[model samples]
Target chain A: MAYQFDFAPVLQHSDLLLTGAAFTLALTAVGAVLGIGLGIVGALCRAWKISPFDRLFGLYVEVIRNTPFLVQLFFIFFGLPSLGVKMTEWHAAVLAMVINLGAYSTEIIRAGIQATPRGQIEAASSLALTRLQTFRHVVLRPALTRVWPALVSQVIIVMLGSSVCSQIAAEELTFAANFIQSRNFRAFETYFVTTAMYFVMALLIRQLLMRLGQRFIVGRPR
Target chain B: MSLVKITGLHKHFGANHVLKGIDLEVAQGDVVALIGRSGSGKSTLLRTINGLETIDKGELVVDGAALHDGKGDLRALRQKVGMVFQQFNLFPHLTAGQNVMLAPTVVKSTSKREAEDIAKEMLLKVGLSDKFNSFPDQLSGGQQQRVAIARALAMKPKVLLCDEITSALDPELVNEVLAVVRQLASEGMTLIMVTHEMRFARDVGNKLIFMHQGRIHESGDPKTVFAAPQTPELAGFIGAVQEA
Candidate 1:
């Protein structure tokens, strides 16, 4: 017996895949924004070594980076509810993705921050700029420019990795693919289409981020 | 009272003591020159005055404030003392005018327009009125150092410190920067300079201090220090420079 190709069932439920992709993109977008916020704070915590808080933040980054994202998702979705912090599957997935991305971005941004020259910091100090002013004008701007390419690639990877959220029934693209496959018994066709959709989404996001980076950062060499 | 005073200053970077019990004083509006061979602690002494280098043991009083005793406000102390580095450490991202304007805007809380006006005036004084919009990389090294000087002066600091301000420039460019310093001294800007340029030291300095092995070997009027240095170390150091 040979496998029969079927397009009718898969095409009929195209709306389901589209909705799933919308959810996936939403999750990635929200997660990325939250992740970048957390990453900047974490990088500053590690960079400034601002007392006990810095060491505590370092521990948080280490644990997040070393563990698998799947396990982290399970901890947020399953483990947290038992501790009286109940969350929806979507919330859990988004939170988990944000935490994972934050850890990686912290290292990337910290490297950028450290790469700034000591002379620059001294000059800022001689100007008598307050700590906050120096960091905003001298350290953060240059650091962000230096690590922008790395940050973009990390965001794209997060977008692709969001497929893993389907394991928790988050109703994203991968979850929709599973549903379509089961209904039509057309596993290969459904998966193939879904994979192509993800590729296109990732490519679009990468291009957009690259354009943003070029416009804001590429020309401003400090 | 001395405008700036250092008494029993001591600093060590690990086992190498960079400043060993340095004592000096500068009256207001005085132009003092520190002359020494490399590694003789001339630069270290300058840095210590501004608290850029922490002292292991000492007292540094600037304009009646104790900088090393931990009793003074360091930020306020720095506002009173402006320093120009050998590398002309201007913020590369900012224009020359912006570089000069930054301290006033941020530290003194001057209005941006007022800061710009002051920056323009300082740039003009440094003979760089045409390079206000120029970045550090856009200017020649001599021009960059002049901007660095203007950047320091924009704070209206009572004291100006120069650490080999012309050492990194080309021979042709050195005179242009030295001229700016000379003009500042002529206007009574209260200057302390570390320099290898013996002729400029002799001409512009009211007082001269010679350092050898992390200590001031001799100090006096420019004529007395340069013509007949009292210490053997000072004489030997000057002899080596002359021979070179």
Candidate 2:
């Protein structure tokens, strides 16, 4: 039998697919803000290296980075229930995304912070700015500016990685595709359309984050 | 009384003794030039005065704030002593105006509007009125150096330390930066400069100091030291600078 492609059956559930896409977008947006925030803090803890945070964040980053995101998602979604800390599937997915992003970005932001020139620190100290003030104004901003492109790339990668949330049947775009295929029995058509949707999504998230970076960071000198 | 008084200042780096029992006094409005070959500790001496480098031994006081104890509250001393580096370390991500405004706003708690006004005035003083919004990479080496000077001046330091500020500039660019410094000198701002520019030292410094082997080998009026060459080390140093 000659195989024919049909997207009509999948398109029939447009409302379901659109809702799934929206959920995916929502998941990524929330994950990004929380993740990047966690990343900044982890990076600062590593950079400043104040006592317990030095060893703590270092170990945290190392552990999370060494482990696969899928395994971490499984541990959060499946493993945590045994420990008596229960959460919904959506919550677990967001938490996994956040934890993963934090570890990855810690190292990225640390590299940016380390590249700050010796002259800049000397200049800040000579001006009598406090250690906290120096990092907040002088050190952190340029560091972020330097590594912005890397940061944006990581954000999109995490967005794409959000597809794994479907493993727990969290009802993201991929889950919607699976549901449509199961209902219509057009497995090839459903999955192919879903893959294209993902491609479009990755591109959109990438452009949107880059635009945010431009508005807040690039070409606007402090 | 001298504005800056250092009696028996000593500094070490691991096993290396960089400054050996240095004794010097800088009066208010004195343009003092520290001249020596590399590794003579002239730069290190300037660094210690501004609390950038710690002293291994001796008393170092700048305008009533003593740093020899290593706990002498550098914050207060730093307000009165500003330093400009050889590298022209203007913050790369900030405009010249913002670079100048940072210290006052952050350290002194000046309002943003006030800091901006002061930054503009200092940039004007450095003769970079048109370059207030330009980033360091956008400007020439000379203009960047001038912005650095304006940044240092924005702190309103009583004694400005210049650590080979012009040594990093190209020959043509050196003069433009130096011209701004000379104006600061004539305007009665106290200056302690470590310089390789012998001609500038002879012309601008009211008092001259020569360092050799981590000690003040000779210190006197510029005309006397340049003409007489009291020590063979200084004479050799002058000869070396002339040939290069």
Candidate 3:
């Protein structure tokens, strides 16, 4: 018997798939921006020894890194409401993604910061650049450039992981695939198309990030 | 008048005493050459003047400004002094022009156009005017060091410290950097350079201070100091360099 593949059944309900893709993009874009911001702040606090902030962020990183991402998503989406912090499913999903990416990027960025040469810092301070100015202009950008590839990979991982949001009825790509499969009983066809979409998105994201790195991170033309 | 003064200065790392009870004065327009064996604390002494190294016990005053306690608020003092390292520590991410312009724009609040203008002028002075758009890695070792000099001079500091500036460069490239330093010295920049260039130090510097065992072994006019050594340590140092 031939294992006849069919994407026509999945392609017929294209609106649902497009809407789900849009939602995936929205969640990942917003989450990535906020998460990168959080990561930089967290990394700086830890790298510069901002006392309570360093210790607190270190604890956050350890807790998030050791646990399962699914568990973390559930805790934010399901557990927080019991503590009087209630949010909609979509809000919970975005918040969970941000927290997850933020922890991973904190360690990534901090390693970059630490690897910055001592002489560079000395030169900046010798020129009387304030500590904040030194970190912003001299330290942070080059550090990000050094570790950008790792950062991009982590972001894509988070994007693919968005599939888990279906568990909370977030109506992302996976949810649309499941909805189509349930409606038409085309499990293999629906999932195959969805997986291919994710692969394409991952490539698009890598290109976007590389362009960003060229424009902002490593400003040297060479 | 002396622009920099250090009295009874002492610095130690753990049980290792790096600078021991040193007293020195550098006047305006004076070029002081610090010459000694590698472990003689000459570099540590130069660094202490700029607050780059901690002084365990001493009084340091630069341009009549007091040394702030525990590295506090050296900003005012540092603004008056510029340092160039041996490795030519140009910020790799920035172009030659941006590297020179960074301190003035950020620390002194010079506008971008003005900073760029100054960077151009300084780079031109070091013969790197054409390399304003080049990255550090794109330039040769000597060109990079020249850019480093330009970066320091962009601050228009009253005093300049060169820590083995040309010691890292090739023999063929050394003169290009040394020429810039020579011009700075001739134009009356107060320079304190720790160098192994015996001939350049002898010919260029007005005063020579020989350090030995974390102490000033001898000090005098360069011609007299090298011609007539006051200590066997100074003689040995000069002999070793001559052989190398």
Candidate 4:
């Protein structure tokens, strides 16, 4: 017996799959914005050595980085309710994604900041700029320009990682695939269609981010 | 009063004492040159004056304000004291004119328009009016140093500290930067420079200090210092440079 590829069963639930795809994209969009915000804060904190705050943030990064994303999602969704704080599945998924992405972004951005030369810092100091002014005007811009490509790739990785949120029953693409497979008894066909949709989604996201990176980060006509 | 004074300055980095018991004085508008071999602490002393290097034990006064004590108003002292470095530390992301205008706009609270005008004037003084809009990398080493000079001058500092400003430039480019320094000195801008160019030090400096082993080995009129160095170390250093 040969493996038969049939689309009719999966095509019947296209609306459900489309809704799931939209939810996945929405989660990624929100998570990326929040994650990048956290990343910038974490990067600056680590770079600036903001005392106890930086130490605490360093611990947060280590914890998030060391553990699996699935465990992190379960902890936020299942574990937090025991502490009298409850969150919806979507909220927990987004939060977990933000935390995970934030840590990775921090490391990437920290490398960028460190790669800035000492000569540049000395030059800024010679201009009689205060430490804060030097960081804002001199150190930050060049560092960001240097690592923006890496940052974009990390963000796309974070987007793909959102599929892991299906474990928390977040109703994203993977969850929708699971639901359609059970309903139609067509696991292979359902997954095949969802996998193709995911490919398209990832490609669209990568293209969009590339355009954005060129517009804002590179800041040159292309 | 001397515009700048250093007495018994000592600085150590871990076990390495970079500057040991350095003493010097500069009257207003004096063009003083500090010449010495590498690792002789000439640059360290210059950096100490600008608070880039903290002194282990010393007193440095610039325009009657204490530099080493850490009690003197740093921003005020820095506002009156400008420095140009060997690397031509212009902000690479900014245009030449903006680089010149930064300190004035930020510290002096000069309006952007006024700051631009001042930057333009300084750029013209450095003979780089045409390159005002250019980036630092776009200019030659000589032109970049000129822009650095203009950036320093835009603050209208009473004293300008130069640390080996021409050391990184090509032989041909050296003269262009020295000419700008000489012009600034001629215009009565007080200049204290750490440099290796023997001829420029001999010709341009009103006073010369030759350092060896983190100490001022000799200090006098440039002609006297170059013609007849007082110490054996100075003699050996001059001899080595001459042979090189």
Candidate 5:
């Protein structure tokens, strides 16, 4: 007996797959924005050693980078309830994605910030720009422009990683894939489509981020 | 009237004692040149006047503000004193106009319209009126240094510091930058320069100070000093620079 390919069974569940994809994208949208924002603050602290937060964010990046994403999700979803902290599965999934991406983007952005030429800072200071002003006006955009590709890759990684949210019953794309496969007993077909969806999403997001970099970060002269 | 006064100035880089008990004075409208061998502390002394390098012991007064005590309003002092570097440190991410307009708009809160007008005027002065939108990397080193000069002048600084402003340019490119500095000097913009351009220093400087072993070994009118170096150190330095 040979494995027979069947499309009808998987096609019947298009509604579930679409909703699941929409959920995954929503989680990614929220995660990338907040995560990069958090990472910017973390990078500033780590790069400039901005007092108390430097040590705190340093510990955060180390811990999150060392641990597996699934464990972090479990800890947020399962372990936190034991300590009287309660959140929905959706909240836990989004929070885990944010923290994970935040740590990675922090390191990436800090590398960019640390690469800033020493003379640039001296020039800004000589022009009477204060430390904060220098960071905002002189140091930040170039740093972001340098690290944007890495940041975009990290975001895609987190989006794919969000598939693990299904284990916590978050009803994301992978959850729908699992639900469809279990009901119709069409494992191979369901997984094939799910994999394709993820591939397409990643490509689309990379294009979106590249356009964003050109428009806002690079701000290239016309 | 003296616009800058330094007395018993001292600076150290972890006991290197870069500048030792230096005393100097600059009057309004003076174009002073500092020339010396590398590691002789002439650059260190120039940096101290702008509060870029703090003094370990002594008094530095620029534009009526005391800077040595570490309590002076450094921003205010810097606003009144502009500096152009050998590297021409224009913000690479910004265009030439934005670079010139940055200080006036941000530090002084000049409106965008006013800042743009000032940038245009400064760029015109530097002969870069057409490069208002060019980024730093798009310009040659000489052009970048000229833009740096414009950026400094946009602040309307009472004094300008040039730290070997043309030293990083190619030999052929050096004169374009030097010409801008010469023009500024002729227009009575007080300038203190650390330079190796002997011809420039001789032609434009009203006073020339030669440093040796962390001290002003020779000081006088440029013509007098170059025509008859009072110290063997000055003679040797002039010889070495001229050979290069």
Candidate 6:
């Protein structure tokens, strides 16, 4: 016999799902901006090999990239408190997402920076541009343009990986789905909606980033 | 008065002595053409003048600034010297105008309006007035080299260094770039160029120095040097080019 399909029970808890979606978006928004910012600094340090920070960021990137994202979130939420560094589940979740995305983007952006032609640097130097000026003006935008697709994919992966925040009781979209399923016993329907919500978010985000790349990285047509 | 002076200059890459105990002087308004076979250290000598390569031992003074091992500020020295490369290394991301304006605005702190005006004037000088908004990739190799010249001239350098400026261009395109350099030469812009264009060098350059085995193998008036070479090395170089 086929199981009966139902929508009423899951639809009644739409408010919870909406709140979860909003929370997950907020986490990703904050994580992406700050994480990419961190990634730029990390990439600079590693690419130019800027002394102690280069070594430090190299270690951080290696560790984060090699380990599982779930374990990172668990360590931030569960383990940090034991070492007297306590934060709410929300803070721990955001921190985990930032660190995770930051590590991935650092490597991605570094590859772009390394591909810069030697002549470009010599030209900038010959023009009397300082080291900082050359990097900011001549080097960065092109580098970002080269690796933007990979960066966008990495960002989307981080956004989806945020579902693990629910395990820490962070009240993101997945947590809402779990809460609704537990209450109404409509597991399949709740999961289906949650999955759709994530797919839509990813699509929207890719569009937003692509538009941004065209406007800023590639420059507007005169 | 001499604008550039080099005395007992020496440069080595590992054990390979690139420039060995060279002495030279370039006066204001002089056009010096450096020509030689590849690996002959002519390019290395030009780079040393621009502070791109440091001297191992000896003195190099350009525009009253010393550029030896560790004496003078490189930025200050570079401000008075402009360099154009064979590849025409225009900043790919910026427009031609932006590329020309970047150094003046950032390094010299020229206002945006002033930098734009200077960029326009320099682009006009290079015959690229219509390409102000074009990206480097959008321009042909000759046009790109002209923009690179405009970018350098925007700095108002006391002297310009051209390292085989037209070597990478197509034969048909070489004259367009050479014409701009020719104009600069006629207008009395001090220039030191490393080139293989024998006829152009004879016509435009006041002095020609043939570098062989890291030394000034032959040096004199360009017409006389081409007409009567005192060294077998110089004669062989001219012969090889003619055959090619």
Best by DockQ: 3
Which residue pairs come into collision in candidate 4? none
Per-residue lDDT of model 3, residues A1-222, tens digit only: 787887788899989998999899889999999998999999999999998999999999999999988899899888988999999989999998999999999999999999999999988988889889999989999999999999999899999998899999999999999999999888988988998899999999999987888788986544
Q: Residue-wise lDDT of candidate 1 within B1-244, one digit each (tens)?
A: 8999998999999999888898899999899999888898999899877778887887988886676643457787788889998899887767899889888888788999999999999999999999999888899999999999999999888899998989899999999999999988999999999999988998999999988899888888997777887888888888988887
Which residue ranges in model 3 land beyond 4 Å of their true spot? A2-4, B68-72
Question: What is the fraction of true interface contacts found in candidate 1?
Answer: 0.42
Candidate 3 residue-wise lDDT, B5-87, digit = tens: 88888899899999889999999999999999889999999887777887788788888666733344588878888999998
For candidate 4, give the lDDT of residue B140. Answer: 97
Q: lDDT score, residue B228, model 2?
A: 89
Candidate 2 vs candidate 3, TM-score winner: 3
Error of 3 at B77 (Å): 1.4
- Which lDDT tens digits does candidate 5 get at residues A1-222? 699999789989999999999999999999999999999999999999998999999999999999999999999999999999999999999999999999999999999999999999999999999988999999999999988899999999999999999999999999999999999999999999999999999999999999988889999934
Summarize candidate 6's per-residue lDDT along A1-222 as a digit string, tens digits.
697879789989999989999999899999999998899999999999999999999999999999999999999999989999999999999999999999999999999999999899899998999988998999999999899999999999999999999999999999999999999888888898889999999999999998898889978653
Worst 10 residues of 5 chain B by lDDT: B64-73
> What value does the lDDT take at residue B227 in candidate 6?
96
Q: Could you tell me the interface RMSD of model 6?
A: 0.6
Q: Across residues A87-195, which tens digit of lDDT does each residue of candidate 4 receive?
A: 8999999999899888988888888778888877776676678877777777776777778878778877877788889888999988999999999888889988888
Per-residue accuracy of model 6 over B1-244 as CA lDDT, tens digit each: 7998999989899999999888999999899999999999999999888788888888888888786653578898889889999999999999999999999999999999999999999999999999999999999999999999999999999999999999999999999999999999999999999999999999999999999999998999999999999999899999999999
Residue-level lDDT tens digits of model 4 in B145-235: 9999999889888899998899899999998899999998898999999988888888988999988899988899999888988888889
Candidate 1 local lDDT, residue B131: 98
| TM-score, first chain, each model | 0.94, 0.95, 0.97, 0.92, 0.97, 0.97
Better candidate by lDDT, 1 or 3:
3
- Candidate 2 docking: what grade? medium
Looking at model 3 chain B, report the run of 10 residues with the lowest lDDT sum: B64-73
